[model samples]
Target: AENARLRAREAGSLAELEAMVAAFDGCALKRTAKQLAFADGNPEADIMLVGEAPGAEEDRAGRPFVGRAGQLLDRMLASIGLDRSRVYIANVVPWRPPGNRTPTPQEVAICLPFTLRQIELCAPRFLVTLGAPATQTLLGLKEGIKRTRGRWVEYPGLVRPARALPMLHPAYLLRQPIDKRLAWRDLRLLRRALDEEPPR
Candidate 1:
């Protein structure tokens, strides 16, 4: 795994990192997954969204955020006057897990480097981790999404530092429509962040 991480660190761009991930065979989840759902949206966007893993639709389409959750995500972005074209989107685990179950810690560890490399390459000004897994994985927080969502946390160890925000996954909102209001609040926070000038 360290070898993979080193290769990932050496990747010159998101495209190269993605190619590495696609060719990676360390994680068992990749074997069960239909395809690699690397990412979607503009790679140069200032805001990057990261989710846990792909669902059935995403696995089939080979693109992140393309299911019902994706439709809701589109609306969520629209609410903040943003869209896929304006923000880059990827997942902590590029490959889908069996039965859409959460990726185990071991699986996550194996795949973390690739995602980290992707983040380093994109160098987005702000990052939004959708759901507790992504939030914990990227932000290094043990707290649940409900506790961390809407709050700002700085993520270092990348090409550039970025302020990250945790938000409820669109899939969660789909299951709990009542929580869309809370998600809306987080979206507003993201909008404000986007409006602010980047630090010197």
Candidate 2:
């Protein structure tokens, strides 16, 4: 909903961007969504994390990863000495897709510009994409989440040494508990990548 494009053009600081995002109402997602669910955690965190979109609870609560999936995410991040307050968290689409369904390409396109502006404003050192939708869209990869998760790929268009590590979505892990182990492995790999280099 934020004027992401204008923010990109004129943003000089994080405070300014947050103020702009708090007032934006461009995307259609804002029409049905209870809240914008703009972002969570430290605005200046070194690590920036992205997820697919808001789910049922997220839609109601107006925050990213704040449901059961979010609880699991917190535990996973704690395993590697990270948490929301220490790392910035957001979503590819700012609003919840209807009925919590996956966002269509048209929806993604509408929101992409704003998200790009957010990244440009935040400028995190490491990038992590949660779940297939986010990884596929962010990396523009045709590969499936199974094939893409845990594989290292460089995120495009950034001023930092950004590495995008795709991991299983917590919602998926809730349904497929067996895959939680796989997600753990992916998290470890993320830890390693984060350790590879400091912010540039």
Candidate 3:
């Protein structure tokens, strides 16, 4: 498994990484998934958003964040004057887990390399991990979303270090609409970060 991850990490380009993930058979989720939801949006964007896994809509469309959650995500991005076109979006687990259930630890472990490599290839200046799985998986943290959201940390896993922020998933906001305020606060913080003038 480590060798596979190493190979993926060494991929020279985003296209190669995508191809590797598509051909990867180490994870079982791929067998049940309709297609590989590799990523969406501009690969060269400065902001990269990582989600937990592909939902039904995402699996069907072979893109991340295309369901009701995706709609909310779009609105959230719009609030900050950004959109999918300005950000790269992918998932920790590119395939959809059965019954829309949370992916098992083993599944995440097997698929981790592809996502890490995707990030390295995209090399975004800002990284946002949506939901707990994505936050923990990419940021290497154990805290839950309630404790981790709205905080800023540096992700060292990428080819170059990046400022990372964790936030509530849009699906969670859909279920608990009141928590949208917290998400709103996080979005504002992100906007401020993006708007900040880079140090000379």
- Per-model TM-score versus the true fold: 0.96, 0.89, 0.96
RMSD of 2: 2.3
Model 3, global lDDT: 0.90
Residue pairs in candidate 3 whose N, alpha carbon or C atoms collide under 3 angstroms: none
The TM-score between candidate 3 and the true structure equals 0.96
CA-only RMSD, every prediction: 1.3, 2.3, 1.4
Q: What order do candidates take by lDDT, descending?
A: 1, 3, 2
Task: Indicate whether candidate 1 or candidate 2 has the larger TM-score.
Answer: 1
Candidate 3: where is the Cα deviation over 4 Å? none
Candidate 1: misplaced stretches above 4 Å? 198-200
Per-residue alpha-carbon lDDT of model 2 for 21-120, expressed as tens digits? 5566666777888877878888788778889998888888878889998999999999998988789888988788889988887777667766776777
What 10-residue stretch in candidate 3 is worst by lDDT? Answer: 191-200
lDDT of 3 by residue, 84-159 (tens): 8899999989999999999988888888877788898899989999999999888877888989999999998766
Q: What is the C-alpha lDDT of each candidate?
A: 0.91, 0.80, 0.90
Question: Lowest-lDDT window of 10 residues in candidate 1?
Answer: 191-200
Q: Residue 160 in model 3: shift from native, Å?
A: 3.4
